[model samples]
Target: MVNLIYDKSPIFLQNIFISLKGIQIYRQRYNKVYRKELKILNEENEFNLQKKRFKSFIKYTRKNSPFYSQKLSHLKKEISMSDIELLPMLTKDEIREHVDEIVTRNKGLLPMGTSGTTGKKLIIYSHPYDISRRIAYLDYFKAKHGVKKGMKRASMGGRTFVPEKQKSHIYWRHNYILNQLLFSIYHASNENIIYYIEELNRFKPQSIDGVTTVIYRIAKYINKHSIELTFKPIAIFPTAETLTVTVKSEIEKAFRCKVFDQYSSSEGAPFIVENDKGYYDICPATGYYELERIEGNIYEITVTSFYTTTTPLIRYRIGDAVELFDTLPENYTQSDIKIKRIIGRKNDYLVSNEKGKVYSAILSATVRKTEGNFIECQFIQNKMDEVIINFVIEGVNDKKTIEHSIKELMKVRFSESTEYNVRFVEELESTDGGKTRFIINNLNRELS
Candidate 1:
């Protein structure tokens, strides 16, 4: 009779409800413990201990990781901390070339796919300990702003892979279980924007995290129409792309919260986070980060994660460019470094209709040639024949001259008869996660 009751319809529903509620309570308890542990780790001297741990991690990676071992094969066993650059920088191509060998055979490592914004998706494996450390870092940062556990977090990102026809209440409950509200970036239309706002108001999350473009678009909608959002979030963390001062200002105004810009990549470590003081702080436990110049002041960012075990990326060249500061600030710890701005990826290049290619650096230089601050730019190729340049100009300038110069530059590079369409926008957008995509090739073309 008891078994029959357990298997029955209404009784089963009750059982599920009870189980879910219990899980939520358990999660709250776990978060409390996690916060306590993180509080201890946030102490000043804790960073020094983390550095020692990082050194051991370096030694372990060199010994266990084949990819790092091969790259740093030339280095002496007694290499000092300053000799980190002696290890050859690993490129995206190199990682893709040796994906299988790069990943550890350890079962404890969790494998995840890269966002594939650059091109093809790459597989990355990280240890459980690494994941825990990452979570801890996040907790410590959130604690600084008093964002404790049980506070709702709204994430605007890739679509949840669940069936779309599922009931909204069910989906909402699932997200709530995870302490997150997942907003779809793929559907950022006006209708979806309203829906997102409604959901956000209902959830009343403490923070909003997503692609910068999507967030900016939402903010623009709210501002243009004067939509007064009743619910205010504590913080907005933008990730995945470059967050310009303009975009940051807009997001801060709309969300009514301090915008924190995160400089990180899926391939490497989550290295830097901006504090309340507008200074970028390096995540000491994440990795040993370095800025190497290929030419002059233009530098390539490199990172070697101490927490990674599945695939230790030693001296990995993350392709992005950065402007480095000469001296560290007094307020910042010795491990912390100041990065003026992350320019763009080295591989981010625009291909002309004539089959010639122009890198992002060239595009940036060309924009500068017109004597204007190019906030952000993206090249959209609809077909092989049609190319559109969408960019934002900083100051009052002759749009025609700037457009003409870009066309001339493209023509000089390609040597092909190409039609150039330039759209000068007031502001370029970023994804909700605060990432700016410079060149989006929609021509259904693949780079060989």
Candidate 2:
């Protein structure tokens, strides 16, 4: 009802509402907790800081969370950094099944939703301290790349804040309180995209952040049309999806700035952000991370986020993978933060003339329902109007039933006119560096 009224309102009114909403939530995120974290961003001796937070997090989890209390009943109240290994590693399914018991607090929690890129939909709760500190880490990351506190910034997010019935070229809303322009990804069709570029030219944002593929699409259009942007941003921070080498290079070329590829989960996972020196460094202050080797230095990530106080994520396997520097101590800690590459989320997209392009962030919706049914699924797009769901089943799930479920999910992201070829494959092939890409879009061949 409120959403309906807000959507039906005029653009000017919508902007005002957006700002009001931003104002209400902005202070909560940038409060004393955030300021304190900012003050300590450059503080040295992170090993000590991590040691303190990690031990405290474990004790807190054991006492407050019913699920963890039972799981870690064997451990003493006082636990050391070395004792972390004894604690069990948590998977998405475990968290989903026991979320009620895992959660420490019942009230004063903020729900953070992930699109289930790993074929699971999850709502992670953030305590006030958790959210505030998280925002601070992100802002501190921007500070490294010359972003100021109150600088004019543009953001491209996956939210559909704009009404579908609207028929205007304008596709963004400005929050004067934060001096930020929020651009809607759903509205950035190939034709109406010019308005977004025009707004960027006029607003002159110092920095840009949001969904990677949407920003990539804008960069692609700018370069294709040879459009000269008046204002050059200091940097671009692409999140929510993977950043491919070609996409990063293209965006940097178009914007005349560096693209800082960041790695963090919507579930408030620890940060592995790109520094100004173009090196990916794991932030020790955010959380304690464990890199268990899957095969020869290529390791799977398990994070214990301090920010998830409302819903503690101790040794949570945040289903992303990475490669680390070969030279490291046997019992490595956060102080030894040497990350070579973040081969995390599937770095692929399905192109569309009407919708521009839908990347993994949005495409992940199709498989959220069929979680345990398949080992992994790959989406192959040969044309703009059709996509093939080639999946490797785990057991005896009916192919037609799974396809029907995915077909329903597809209608939400893509046009109902689009076609799908659902197939059961023996095994899906891996991409470069053994990364299993969920999307294999051959549209680039057509475009080239």
Candidate 3:
């Protein structure tokens, strides 16, 4: 019944319904507790502030969460800063098996689902307090770049508001309460891109936010068609995917504005914000990050988010990895934890007959050949020796030249014996959450 109204309702009424829903989220996200978190964003301390947050979160979890109570029972009730590492890391499987026990609060909880980009998806619960603080942290990052509350925002999130059978160029809905213009990523195909560009010009948004890949696709169209937009956004903030230098450069060139990249997952991990100087700085007040060495300079991210007290993420293995300096730096939460590239999922890698296994970092760089004359591509590796490349080429570009270049590049990376089948498609498919997955490694988990 609700689905019927959502699909059949007029755009104005739909916007009203969406805004009403936004009011519910706005209350939870921008409350009194969020105001305090915004202040903490600028609080000065050498290291004591982050140290204090960790201890408080640990103390709260140890006292309230039944799972953590027994898990950390052996340690002193007052776990010291150094003893943080002593706490066992939380995995997705463990959280799934013990969600009820892991949650500290039963009432006033919000359930956020993980994207499962890494093959593991679970529902994470958050208290209103944590949810508000998390929003504060994100808003603080946006504010620094001139996107404040109530400003018009054009977002390309996973909003499937438009019915699939609808036949029209109109692909967006407005949320007036938050002053947000929600664009449908589902309808962002090449044919519908003109509508997006026209609507964006008409809406004149102050800032554009959402999935990095979705925005990248749109930017490619603007550049390919040489379409000049009338309204320039103050900033383009891309989330949920790894941003290569090449991808960032193209987005900036298209919008004639700086791209501020920020990182946080659906599960509410700590914020890794790209500063004005283009460095990815971990916001200490938001969470405590630990690295579990995978090999060489690559390490998986484990976090203890301060706001996730409802479902404590103490030493949680978040399934994403990053490249770091040879000698990792240590500091109290008062300072920034600088990071290099955010590599792809820890389990995301392609099998190479010669190279054995090519992880996401290498694969990201490998796809850099699509910088021009190609919008985007997804690599589907179903067999060790066979790989299918599905890509969308720029409308005016020569297809033969792009195909030859891609196959030639893959030969060097995957060896001469490897099969590289490249095909051109009008629209590339997105992940379940409306994210453009660069690679989908479907090889059996145990084998890969």
TM-score list, all predictions: 0.66, 0.85, 0.76
Where does candidate 2 stray beyond 4 Å? 42-44, 327-329, 344-347, 364-384, 387-413, 420-448
RMSD of 3: 11.9
Give the winner by lDDT: 2
Candidate 3 per-residue lDDT, tens place, 1-448, comes to 9879888887778889888988987887888898887887766551566788888889999899999999999998777667776889788789878999999998988887543443223679987888788888788889989889888899987645776557777888888878999987545655667889999999998999986766877888888889999998999998767787877988898899999988777677887888888867787777888876778778778888887889988888877787765635444332434577678543366777665555443444456533336655677788888888876765846677767876876775455788888888887666666755667777875431
lDDT order of candidates, best first? Answer: 2, 3, 1
By TM-score, the better pick of 1 and 3 is 3
Residue-level lDDT for 23 in candidate 2:
89
Q: Look at candidate 3 and tell me the lDDT of residue 288.
A: 83
Q: What is the C-alpha lDDT of each candidate?
A: 0.62, 0.79, 0.76
- State the lDDT of candidate 2 residue by residue for 247-308, as single tens digits: 89899989999999998887888888987676688877778888878887688888988778
Which candidate gets the maximum TM-score versus the true structure? 2
Query: Where in model 1 is the C-alpha error above 4 Å?
Result: 1-40, 44-50, 67-79, 115-117, 161-174, 294-298, 325-336, 345-448
lDDT of 1 by residue, 1-448 (tens): 6434333434335335444664754554445545554655766564575567556766776687676677667777755456665667777677767867776565765666552433223568865455555666776777677676558787766432223333343222224455766665534544457767766778788888877766876886687778889789988887665777878888888888898887767655746778788757777656776765655455666777765667777777666666656543434333556666667543354555433344433343344334334444566666666667776766656576767777875654333477878887775444455765656555555442
User: What lDDT does candidate 1 reach at residue 184?
Assistant: 54
